[model samples]
Target: MTVVELEVTKSADELAKTYIVKGILSEKKEDDALHVAIATCAEMDALVTWNFKHLANLRKAELFYSASLEKGYLKKLEIVTPMEVSNYES
Candidate 1:
């Protein structure tokens, strides 16, 4: 990747870590948080995960969405499991 690409990636990484440090993600689930953070930062409409204990739970989803909105992530995010999506598609 070009220097600019590398820099952008670094910035996104920092932002993901910031979410954890700021308590947006409980218990420092860095990898799981990173996945959600990426989707949030990218302005995706949904994050489909099997991580019901964290990323896919109602409480955690609410927290993530609220914190993201407060931090200027305008697009509201939906957290769902892959099964949820597949069922919807079916």
Candidate 2:
């Protein structure tokens, strides 16, 4: 298994802050925002997670996608579960 390099940039932090400020993610969930922001800024293909309420919901996905685009990230980063990715690989 290849270990993905964690990319944490200033832009990523800003993106996370933006989400919180816009109420896309609650203040209590800044860490969750950071996870998505890092994945987005790193240009990862997807963010694999089990946290449905804060990290793996479709409504949040749409909002994150738009926020990322607004921040000039052109790539569409998918938020999914490990099982979902495994199935996709087949």
What does candidate 1's lDDT look like per residue over 1-90, in tens digits?
111111235545665676687786754688777777777777666877788887888888888777677667778779998777753422
Q: What residue pairs are clashing in model 1?
A: none
Candidate 2, residue 62: CA error in Å? Answer: 0.3
Index of the highest-lDDT prediction: 2
Error of 2 at 42 (Å): 0.7
Best by TM-score: 2
Writing each residue's lDDT as its tens digit, candidate 2 over 1-90 gives 345878678999999999998889999999999999999998888999998988788998999999889889999899998778764422
TM-score to true structure, per model: 0.72, 0.89
Candidate 1: which stretches are off by over 4 Å? Answer: 1-11, 26-28, 86-90
- List residue ranges in candidate 2 displaced over 4 A: 87-90
Error of 1 at 70 (Å): 1.7
Report the poorest 10 consecutive residues by lDDT, candidate 1: 1-10
- Please list the Cα RMSD from the true structure of every candidate, rounded to 1 decimal place: 6.0, 2.2
